[model samples]
Target: MLKDFKPTLFILARFILIYLILLAIYQYFLNYYSGTGLDPYSKMITEQVRYIQNYLGYQTQLYNDIKNEQVYFYVRNDYPTRMVEGCNAISVMILFIAFVFAFYKGLKIFTFIIISLILLYILNLLRITGLNIIMTDYKEYGKIAHDFIFPSIIYGGVVILWLIWIKHFVLKDKVSNELKDKI
Candidate 1:
């Protein structure tokens, strides 16, 4: 039964298990620190971003005067990368999940988690930067890019990366062996 089971599927299951465990840990910390379900890491990034905006001259002086609370301009959807409330956290979670899945399936340790994570992070940063450029250049199309195009880019890259890893690395030898054995 084990022999017949596709190695890629087995590895994917392993990845899911690892991902779930990490997600649980992150959730615990987030809740403990924030008094809410929001991810603490994301919150920190947002706060830092808000600070930067003030330095960039986007602070609202009226709000600062009236409420003594600095109000800064925030382009909520400008860069999908900064949408830590969902996109960033979810992508981070998925990276770990993909790593575990690939690792359990017999992928090389370096290729399994670290390389995959590095690839994802680079792409994620590009996505964020691209979104920012789009927002700056063409405000009208920013929403579509943020809501649809960028996500498709990230997810599509993930799918292709996993498929390639399984095809060329993990299952490559086993599939070849089966064919040779059959012959």
Candidate 2:
């Protein structure tokens, strides 16, 4: 029988890769004026959504009225934003590591990985856009969605990508056959 694929390398490489990528992006953002240029031009989208919500006078006083519940690493509005930020960090690293693993393991590097990365980033922007809309439309549920639910959706996507890479490219029957022989 084939051994289960361990996420240790995937996880570790993801951490290092994402840290470096974030450092580069942070430096770029610092050197470049306006946070507007950073993401999929979503600043405008978020702004428009927020403006529309405000203009509609749909005052759902849910978020404003609730007293924040205390939890580790959670302080009021900080948790949702933090979760989104963490997802960004994790997603970048996961993509980078997956690409490297695929390439090193003799898979089509640029064709599969580059396209997947682009799609991942696009989907990420969509997630952010949806989160922005939700945060505005349902102020009361913002914390629940952003802090827990939204991050899960994004992480779920990353897991699915990893599974695809493993099933089709990385840990294929050939790999399992070799491992069985060696064992």
Candidate 3:
């Protein structure tokens, strides 16, 4: 019975350990940029969003709100969205990275983690851009779009990536071990 639960306990422990370590690092990062009113991550994300929106032919402007530590996104002179630390998606990336490392199989997993993080980052950029466009063009739907639709898209992307990693890495290793035991 003890043996039966050992693997489950180990996995849980690993997950929690990795999650806490990564979260601590993230908190430290936020603290380091707290009073400065200039978070590099948020700034980079805002710039990317601006580039993306401009490339899509939507004339946009960015205003740094130093007091609030946020960047507002203006579309055609209307402030429709703001980019903050949360909007930058580093938290989401941290969570994803924690999960991937918790189930670490080999060094090759690093490559997969990097690729997945890049995809997730791109997905988040698109989500923010789309949300800004929708909010600017459709004010009445802004609440639902921000509160429901955009969250679903970014989180759903994370779930899909997790499933892919589990299927290709974790479960594959487990199945191989089981086959070896049978042989």
Candidate 4:
């Protein structure tokens, strides 16, 4: 009975362990910079967003409200977009990483994980940039765009990446093994 469930149990345990460990490290990182304005990663992300806005010809200013631990981006002196720790997408990245590590295959997996993380980061940046634009020009639709559309884009990207990994790496290996056994 136990033997029958061994693989399933192992995968579940691995996923939980990796997710918790990564989450703990992330929490410690946030706590370490609790008193400061914004954590370094979040600040970096905000800075990149500022640059993107500027390049897109929007007059942009970044105000770091250290007291509240929030960064606000002002565009063309209009409504500002508030950026917090969650805006940086570290949590999403952590989830993506945990799923990848849970289904660890081989050394090649590291490359895939790195590439996926980079793509996820870029996707987040674009998401934030688009959100800023929406908030600035179409204030009425900001709520729906932020609350529903943007999150779906990021999470959808993660799901697609997970599917690619399982299909290309995990399932491929299983199929190959079955083929070998048949022959």
- The lDDT per prediction is 0.58, 0.51, 0.90, 0.92
Better of 3 and 4 by lDDT: 4
Backbone collisions counted per model = 2, 0, 0, 0
Between 1 and 2, whose TM-score is larger? Answer: 1
Model 1 agreement with the true structure over 124-179: per-residue lDDT tens digits = 65675566556655789988999899988888878777777767766787788899
Better of 3 and 4 by TM-score: 4
* Whole-structure CA lDDT of model 1: 0.58
Model 2 misplaced stretches (Cα beyond 4 Å): 1-103, 176-183
Which number leads on lDDT?
4
Ten contiguous residues with the weakest lDDT in model 4: 74-83
Q: lDDT per residue, candidate 3, 54-78, as tens digits?
A: 9998998899998899999989989
Q: List the residue pairs that clash in candidate 2.
A: none
Cα RMSD (Å) per model? Answer: 6.5, 9.6, 1.2, 0.9
Which runs in model 1 stand beyond 4 Å of their true positions? 1-16, 35-82, 89-103, 179-183
Ranking by lDDT: 4, 3, 1, 2
C-alpha lDDT of residue 107 in model 2: 49
RMSD of 3: 1.2
Q: TM-score: which is higher, 1 or 3?
A: 3
Ranking by TM-score: 4, 3, 1, 2
